[model samples]
Structures are given as structure tokens and as C-alpha cells.
Target: MSRGKHARRRANRNRATLEGEVAALTAQLVRERKRLDQARAGARRADTAQARLTAETAAAARVMAPVEAEATQTAAAVGPACTVLTEAARELARCDARLSRAAGRSADPARLRTALNTGVRAHLDSVHRSAPLEYHHAAFRRRRGVDTPLCRTLNVGGWIPPEIAGTDHDRIAAHMASRAGEHTRAALWCWAVPPWMGLPDGTDAPGRRTALGATTTGAPDLPDGEFGGRLRAGAVVGTPWRHRPLVALPEDAVDLAYWYRRSAWTQNWHPHTRPVPFWLGDEHAHGFPRSQPLPPGTDRRLPFPAVIVVFESGWQLPARHPDPPDTRAPTGLLYARGHGPTTPPLEQPLYRLAPGTRRDELATPLELVDRYGATVEGLIFTADPDGHPTDEFAWCLAIHHPWGLPLGRITIPASRRATHWTTAIDNTLAGVCLAHFHPTATSTGSPGADPSSANAEPHARDDADVHVLDIAATSPTTGSHRTPAHAAGRAAHLRRATWRYQPVGPGRQHRRWTWVRATIVGGRASSRSTVYRLTDT
Candidate 1:
């Protein structure tokens, strides 16, 4: 036993004692934690049980209250007044059944009318006449009728008045018809296409109407007729049935008569100042040539978007159908056009007069030449190089260009032995000249031609480049409505053709760099281009 050895033994004993204390304390902490978890779980269970009791108490109260309320309602329904009304209703049903047996299956309408002279209809007629005109007028403007609301309110207390009950069908139907009318009248304004192409005013008024497409009650705001009130009460104006002509039309009117059918069957926008738009930017546009040599003064170098319209005729009938017997109705080409590429006239899928070939639409008015004489034509848009809007024939005259490409030519079959594109508009030639014609500085020499086509002319040689004009010296069918101002507004449309940075990379290039000139010809599009690639010489 040295002093150092004694000190080491003391240290070992002290370390062992501290280890025992630490192990005992850890065991006590574990037991305390286990007790805490158990106590918390017990509290949660107690809370859940209390909530369940509260919910069950509320549910029981809810269930009992309805049962008690229903019992009270049942007693009230069986009161003396209800008992009397129920007996009366049963009596009426018995009376009606007996009346049916006595009257036989088909009662004579005249005799029935005579017997029920002072019946429900008569009473309703008197009531209608007595109503202040303003009240009924509101029905058309608003969505309610006077008699309908009166009938409803009277029946609200579970008591059906006999008069209203007897006339239930008539009143209810009138109310329903009035509701059907509310949308169109309440809409403020909209347009519909008339079936007949030769209608008096023509077809198509643009956004001239209010967004709703309703009109301001024309002429007088108040009714002005022999029986306007009665008519208003009985009929809803602007409805297909109510507005239709009562008398039938003759066979000659059959084609135009198609408009009298249901509104849903007729054209959607019609009955306007004219079929073709009066103004170029109006709901329609002029025609632009796809390719042509400049007529005279036309600047060929100035690039602009060439445009044309593609639209369906009034009806989707064949490109050429039998003209109506009424020859006075102008059987030749009439154009019906509209504004926009949105919802363009898509001819339904049908068998083309040719076997197996289906053309969804007619490409141009020229297509109808041999058929119904290609009387009617329509165009959508047209513009020239100086940002000026010019139509097909006029474009050539204005630009000193010759009509090129397809040019919507109506070539006469050699068998017909007539000139191609001889139309009524070409008054000069009865004999065949060019199927189409354009005003030229040189004489066509065949028959009746414009004076401008004869004698020494500065642009006579330039007209030779154009196929349409070269066909004959006769003046081409220029736009009936095309004006110089129309071509002057070309800047707006030309802006649309300027180069835009397409979101394209070299990897996804559908096209390479090239000088491309574009034009919209009728509904089809074509371009003349010269491609170029970069190279180091």
C-alpha cells in the first residue's frame, strides 16, 4: 500500500457509484413518460365521448322536430275549409266524367261553341280587353304577362279559382309563348337571313343591331292597330309563327317562299339595304387578283397583301340549279357576302354533282357560269401593292397588271360554241368574245366594246399581258361598287403582311430564307417566291 495506489482505488469506487445513480434515474424518467402518454390518450377519449353525446342530442332534436311539424301540418290540411274544397274538386271530376260520356267522343265544335257561348274563353277575352294597354305591353319588354301572374297569385293559397282552372291550358300556353319571345325581344337586336335570295331589301345587316340583336319597336312605340291589345295578348311579334304571312304564295315564289318556314330553318342574318356591302370595310370586301401583270398605272414593285373573299351563297344548293320560273327576278349572278374569316360559310359534306368528288364549297362565282348562268357572286377582301385595296379586274386596270394564274375564269365549253364568260353585265357583245372582259385601251374589234378599247392607247400593250383582258377588247366586269378610295385604304391591310418574328429556331425550320410574295386569291392562297442561301465565294 503506497499512497498513490490508495488514491487510484478511491477513484474507481467513486466512478462505479455515479454509474449506478445515472442508470436508476433513466429508468424513472421512462416510467414517467409512459404515464404521461397514457393520461393524454385517456383525456382525448373523454373529449370524444362528450362530443358524440352533444351531436347525438342535436340529431335527435332535429329528427323529432320534423316529425312533430309534419303531424301539425297534416291536421291543418284536414280542416273544414280543406275538407270542403276537396269534396268540391271530387264533385267536379265526377261531373266532368259524366259530361264526357254524354257529349260522346267527338263533340261538334260548332255546337260546343254555341252551347259554351259565355264560357272561359269569352271571359278571358273580356278581361284582356279591360286590361290597361301598358300592363300587357310590359310583358313583351319584360319577361312577364299580366294574366299569368294574376292566375298564379290567385292559386297561391291552395285554392284554384274555377275560371282559371277551366282555362288552364290556354293561359299556360300563352305564358309559355311569351317566355319564348322574351329572349329575342329582350335581346335588343340581332340579324337573321331570309330564305329568299331575291328579297325586297336584300339580306344582311351587320352589327347595326344592339348586341342582343333586337330592334327598337319600329314606327310607334305604342300599338297602333284595330285590335293591337288583343293581338299582343294572343300573339308574340317577332316569333316565326306570329310574324309569318298568313296567305300562301304561288309556285313562282317557291324558291323565295322557303323563308316562311320556322326561324331556325331560315338564314341567320338578312333583310338589309343590299346583299353586297356598300362600303369596302363594311361587313364585306372587294376582290384582289392572285397574279397579274400591272394594268397601267399599278406599281408592281410595291409589295402588299392581295385579298379575296370566299362565301357560300344564300343556300348551300348546287353550284348551278334550275332558275325559278319567274325570269324577271334576275336569274343571273347575285353576290351575298360578309365580313371576316371567322365562321366562313362551310358547305356541308355532300355528293358533288360529279360522282365521288365532294367539293365542300364553290371556289368562285365563275364556277356557276354554265349552270344557273352564274348570276350571283360574292367577294370577301381585296388590296393592291400601294397598300390600296383593289378588286380583281380593277386591280389590273389600276396597277397596269395582266390577270394571271387561275383568275377565276369561266371558260365556255367548245361545244357551247359561245364565248367564255359572256355575262349579262357585258352588254357590248352578243357574239362570243372573251368569256371574261376588261376595259382595254385597244379595241376588242369583235362587237360592242368600250370606246377606251379602241384607237392608239398608251397602255394597250400592257393589257396584252393580262389573260382576262387579252381574251377580248370588251371591258372586263369591274366591281359594281369598287371605287378609287377603296384602293387608297390599302395601307391598313398591307400592314398585316409585314414581316413578323416567328417563334422559330434553325432546328424547327419549316422554311428557309427566301423572298416570298403572298396573295389571297378567293379562298385559296398562293405565293411567288425566289429562294436564296448564304455562301462564301
Candidate 2:
């Protein structure tokens, strides 16, 4: 009970005191932390309010700026005219507003007229003019109208201003008619089919040309003119409407007429040069036998994606005559060469369509051929494979390979012949072809490719591989004044427009191949999609 017991009691009391102090301090710290959190939340609210107010202030300033600027301008314009009469002051204000609008938004008439004149000049340069005067004296005289009595008498050629001629359809007709004689002018064109089987030996008979079955005929009345009979092999048939004739050499009588229509139609519309015959090389025409042997020394390996053009002959009236007219424009067979396989053209859907069943319901040229039984024909006007950059045909041909698979043949029924294809349709074809030929070429997934795939590449545009070639345009008809020059100028005005991509995939494949549809319009594409894959039945 001594000094040790007293020391233990004192130590316990000290420990209890220390515990009370620690509890008090912990409570105070909790209160302080709560206060800090509340303050921070309030600060966040204030910041949000400040940001909203700043946005509102900026919006108000923007709204006021235009009014303030107009007021300042009005004040400046009213200087020194403060005492002017009310009417005069009002007039000044109107004039100032007009000046602002003209400077900012309105088109200048002078600039527009200058642009039009430039286009006309460019057009005239492209047109084929009569041969330059043979002699210097003749050239001088011709310039003065000494040699152009017809031009002077008819008041055509350069005599009539283009403004008047272009506006007045009748005057344009007269101007064109005056340049060419009635005898030379084509009344109606004929597509004389060559007898590919007439050879003594059947060695060269590429089974009946599958593509040549498209006999385009119109039900309309025949134009009033002599339908020229079969001409000699060397004789030229188709002379353009006005310009000098560009002759096409044919190997046989039927070939002569076919070239005649080709030359005539091309010259009348294009009038720039001869149609370059593009041959499908051996690789492209592998399974399809040769109707006639390739031209001597002609390379069989070159890739010419151009298809044969089948034009509707005015002489053959399918509606009137059950069988194609045999007397004048004989029903000719067109053979399309195939690259991959040799299939029976007659067994294809195009040839197997129910008799008298026309494809009026199908929308695309390809659909008409593959689904509804149509035949393929090449383009009427052959474009130079290595022609000018802006040449519509050349551009189409050059880009076709990259954009899509070869349009082996084009299809159209005798009943549903069209002038041209729409821009959307043409773009769709490009997309379909691109999807088939260069499936991975586009940034956008190829048609029918899985969209959600992690490995799928990005797409640059929604249109996939389609690109705008030119605006839709029509070629000049028999008496129309439209020149190749005008077509070229119009093409320049075309702005790019996007066509949405439509997926054409394995579902759209066909067994037999077809060609690209050819139309009379200048820039519009009316091509059929050729079957890329053939399924064994």
C-alpha cells in the first residue's frame, strides 16, 4: 500500500484525459471538412452561371452587330445631305442599299456575257470546218464570201448572229440544212448485219454471236426518203448532216452499212474524228470463238473495254412485222467475246425470255438483260482510246476498268430503247462495278461487306466507288443545231453531285455476260452490268 499503488492510479487518470481530447479534435475536423465541401460546390455553381451569362452576352453582341453596322453606314451616307428633301433622301438610301447588294451578292451581267462568249469560241474551235482554202487567193476570196454563194444566198453560216440562231429553232434548222445537200443528208440509218456464218468453212464460226441478238426497231412511221440498198464494200454510206463525210472502211457489204450508220451517227453528233474500233483481245474473248479472224497484225492481248454499239434502225419495224425485216435491214447476229467461260448464249435468260415478253418493268440496263432477257450492243460512236482528256467516251472508257468490272455487253429490247441513262443510274453502275472488281479499293466497305466487322476499312464517302462523269445531256438530233463544241462547253458547266451507293453483291450475279448499254446522249451512261460470276447448273 505504499508509494507504488499511488503511482498506478495517477497513470490511469492521465490516460483517460488524453482520450477525451482526441475525441473532441476528431469532431471538429469532421465539421470543418463538411463546410469545405459545401463551399466547393457553391463555387462550381457560380462558375457554371458565369459561363452561361458569357454565352448569352456573346449571342446578344452578335445580334446587335449587324444593326449597329447598318446604322453607322446610314449615318455616314446621310452626312452633308441632312437638309435634302424627304424624297431625295429616301432615294439616296435606296441607291446605297442597291450598291451594297450588287457588290456583295448580285451577279454581274458583263461577266456572265463574257463567260458565254468564251464558251462559244471554244465550241467553234472544236467543230470540223470545211477544209482550208486550197489556194491563198481562194482563201482571201472565201473570207469575203466570194466562194460561199450558198451561205450568202441563204443568210446562214456566219451571217446570222449566234444569239438569234440559238434562240430560234427554225433558223438553226435552216442554217444546218443549208450546209449539206439533201442527197447527202441521211434520211434514215441502217445497221446491216454481217453473215458471220456465210464462210465456206465453219472453222471461224464463233457459235452464233450471243450479243448480236438485240434487233432494235421503232414502231413509228418511216421517214420520207430512199432507204439505200446494200452498198459496195468501199462505198461510204453515212455522211454527216452538215460537215464533210468521215468515211469508215468495211470489209463486206453488210460491214459497209454498219460502218455507215456508225460513221454517220458519230459524225453528225461528234463530228470530230473517226470511231476507233476497240477489239476485245484474246484474253477478254477467251471462250467466245472469233466470228471473223482478228484484223491482220492486230494485237489479240490489248484490253479495249469498249462494247459494240447497236443502234435502232428506222427501216426495221418490229411491231408491224413479226419477224425482223429481211429485205432492207437484215436481222444481224452480234457475238460478244467472253473471258472466263464459254456458255451457250441462247440458253441465257436474255435469249430464254418468253416469246413476246418485253422488259418494260426492269429499271437498270443490267436488270433488263440478266432478269428480263435483253441483248448487248456496243456504242455507236467509237471514242479514241487515247483521245483528249475531256472526251466523254474516252474518260468513260479509261475509268471503267478501275471503277468496275468490264461491261462485256449492253442490253436493250426492241420495245424499250432509251436515249440515255440517268446520272443516279450511271453512278450506281460505277458503285456496283467497283464493289465487284475492286472490293477493297474504296474506304467505304464494299457492297455486301459486313459493316460491323472490326477489320473493315473506313469509307471516304457514302457513295463508295461512284464518281460523277458529267451532267445528263442529249445529243443533237437530225436537224438540231447542237454541235460537239456546245456539248463540250455544257460539260464544263457540270458540277459534282453525289449518288448514294446501292449494294450490288453476289446476289446480283448472273451466269451469262452482257455488255454496256450505249445511248445517243452525249455524256449520260446507259450501260448494262455484265455477269462477273457463272454458276454451274
Candidate 3:
């Protein structure tokens, strides 16, 4: 076409092309707007999800705190029973070692035998003093002037001693053999003194009869006083007989007076202490019959005293049952005579007094008043160094709190009586008040009065504090005229961002977040995010 025609045609074609380009651009713009809207919607949804997650995390944290605190407390209280068991095991091990050493040293058998014999003799003596027959027979002979030997034994290995000969010896030997073994017969020997006898030299005095009708003096054969008569003859017969160093009597006229005096003296003097009157019956006076059959429904009560004097070394007077009545006599002696000239005014008072007049009361004046008030009962007293009746020491005392908690122990000084009344009162009040006022938060397992049990808890409550964070995003972008510049423009055009988080519990859980700035190039998108989770204070 000519220059004019060509320019016009070109113009028309350019106009048409430009129009089409405009329409395409418009369509592209609309598409981009829709994508942006979609991205915005996605971002909103992400934000919503993150918010829900944050709420859930906070709720969980709230539930865990108290549980954690309880767990920590429980761990602290379970450590004492283990400690006691460990100590008990150590003590048992020590006792075993001592026993082993004693058993190993058996070389000096003679000395050991002597020691054992001495111990055995001591045990036998204790048995005799406690035996009922020893007391009853002694009483019977003194009253009737006739000796009825409980045991008739004179066997000495293959030889019979000259002192225990005749029909008496044979009867005694037969009776002893029936009760004990042949070796026992060989080891044992006996001598009988005619009525009104004395004990052998170095022998303990015979037990004295002290009741109202009991004999106090020697019979006709031996005129010297019963105890005095026994002191002179050194009677080895019925009184204080020894198994070793056999005694033989002359076959002819026996020295009846000599034996009588000896027996009397021996019966009067106690082996452990000076001569003292036997007041109470022997310990075995209340023994059960071995061979005799009892009627049905026999109610046997223990015959020994309930409270024995426990020495520091653990030896007790009358160590076993059937103890001699006069053994370990109290320093002060009081006789309970029938209503006669010797009886005291307080012996049987018509009305009970605040303090009973018995000389051997166990309780102290203060303990009786504080614990039991002023209701007076019969008292038992032990003598002081000077032989005066004194109050007894309260050995053990404990205080219980109102909630049954036992707080502490009160130790008293060694004395016959309590020094002051205030000590017991103060201890009881303080212990009870403290336990009642402050209910320990520690789970005391029981309401019983044991202070130790007042602070324990079961083991199931521990939790850790936590924080949460959730992030979500959606974006739409387009690239098409397809140049790097165009892509960059699209990337720059649309963007949505959201950050959400919550503390794990109602209390604030510390949290920190850092956002890393992003550098955009071309149409590509990138995000940089960081979160720092922390604990609750």
C-alpha cells in the first residue's frame, strides 16, 4: 500500500491488537484478584486453627500443676522405715559374733567345768529356795518334830556313803532313782538330821517360819533358839544340803543336839543377806501338780510378781519363778500382825487416804495425782539408801495429742518420787496443743496418735509446664508475561501473615518469638520463623 494507505492499515491493526491485549490484561488482573482472595481465606483459616491449638495447650497446662506439686511432696516423706530396718540388721550381726567366740574357746575344760558347775549349783539353790516343799517341809518338821524327807537318795557311784545307810537310805535312793536318771543318783547325795537340827559350816541358814502359827524357836531336843541352835551344830541333814563333799553320819547315837542347833542357824540366815524372817510363802507355793490330775476347767494364774526390779545389768531378783520369799528383802520391814499391840494406826484405815501407807508402793506421788487424781489405793514402796520408805520412780510416761498424735517423750531423773508435778502437766499440754492446732499439710496416713504417720502422701501428681505456638498461611500468585520482572511483581503484589500462641496453663507460661525478615526475589515466596518456649514461674 502507498505510504498513506499503509500507515492507515497499520494503525488499524495496531488498534485491534492493543484492544485484545487490554482484554487479556484485564482477565489476568481478575485472576490475580481471585487468587489473592483465596490466599487471604487460607490465611484466615490457618489463624483460626492456630488459635484453637493454643487454647487446647493452655487447658492441658492448668491440669498438670497441682499434680506435680503432690508428686514432689510424696518423694520427701518415704525415707524413715528403710533407715530403721538397716539399723536392726546391724545389731543382729553383732550378737552372732559374740556367741561364736564363746563357743570356740573350749581348751580349759576344767575351769570351764568349774564355772558351769558353779552356775548349775547357783541355779539349783535358786530352785530350792523357790520350791514349795522346802518351805512346807521345814514348817512341818518344826510343828510336829518329825522329819519326812521329800527325797531319799544316797547312791554314790558304785559305793554307798556310810552316813546314808540303813532302811532310810534305801527308800531315799529308790525314790530319787524313780524321779531322776542313774547318773543323777551318782551325782547326788543326801543327809538327814533328826528333828530340831542345825546346818553345816559355811552353809546358808535354814528358812525361818514367820506366820502366826509357824515355829520361831527350836524343839525340845535342841534347847537353843531354833535359828541359834542351827548355827551351832552345823547340820548338813535336812537344811541347805550340798551335793558335793559328801557328809557321813555316825551309825550310833547321832549328835541330835548338834544337828538341831546347826539346822536352826542355817534355816534362819539367808544365803544372800544377813538373817531375816521369811514373811511371804515361797515362790513355788503356787506351782501346778505334775502327776496329780486336775478337775475340769482349771484356771491357772501366773504366780510370780508382775513388776520385777530390773537391774541395769538386766539381772532380776528371783530371776525365775518359785523365788524364796525372804530373798532380796526390802531395806525396811513391816509385819502385818493380827489386830494386836504391834499394829499401826494406818494399817487398816476406815477411809482411804490420799496416800496409802504401804511401804512398797510403785507409783510416785506426783504421777498418781496428775494421771489418776486423788483416789488413793494401796501403796508399795522401796527403801531409800537410809532405809526409809520412799516413792518409786515413774519409769515410762507418754503424752498423746488431741488428734492422737504422740509428740515427745519425757524422761525423769532417778529418784524414789517425782520432783515436781508441773513437768508432766506441761509436757502433756504442749504436745496435745501443737498437734491439734497445726494440721500438717503432709498427708498423715492415719488419724491415730502417731506423730510420724501424720505426714505422708501417695505418689501420683507431677506435671511439667508447657507453651504452644501454631502458624498457618495461604497465598496465591501468578506468573505469565513471564519475565523475571513480571514474576517479582506478582510475588510483591499478594501476601497474608498471621501469628498465634497461648500459654499452656491459666498462669502465664513465658514464651518468646523471633521473626526473620524475608528478602523476596522473582516470583518465589519464603517465610522465616523462630519460637522459644519457656517455663511458668
* TM-score top scorer: 2
TM-score versus the correct structure, for each prediction: 0.15, 0.18, 0.17
Q: Model 2, 412-502: lDDT tens per residue?
A: 2211112232222223222222211211222243566554355754322221221111112111113432335546644423222222223
Top model number, lDDT: 2
The parts of candidate 2 lying over 4 Å away from their true place are: 1-186, 189-257, 260-267, 285-386, 389-391, 394-537
How many clashing residue pairs appear in each of the predictions shown? 46, 20, 52
lDDT of each: 0.27, 0.30, 0.28
Residue 157 of model 2 has an lDDT of 23
Query: Which regions of candidate 1 are displaced past 4 Å?
Result: 1-108, 111-125, 129-537
The candidate, 1 or 3, that scores higher on TM-score is 3
Angstrom error of the Cα, residue 26, model 3: value is 2.4
- Alpha-carbon error at 172 in model 2, in Å? 24
How would you encode candidate 1's per-residue C-alpha lDDT over 354-444 as one tens digit per residue?
A: 2332122222222222123321121212234354433221000000001111111111101111212212112111111111222222222
TM-score of 3: 0.17
Deviation of model 3 at 290, angstroms: 81
Model 3 C-alpha RMSD to native: 39.2
lDDT of 3 by residue, 167-270 (tens): 67555445233310011222122112110112122211222111001222221122222222122122222212111111112210012222222323223312
lDDT of 1: 0.27
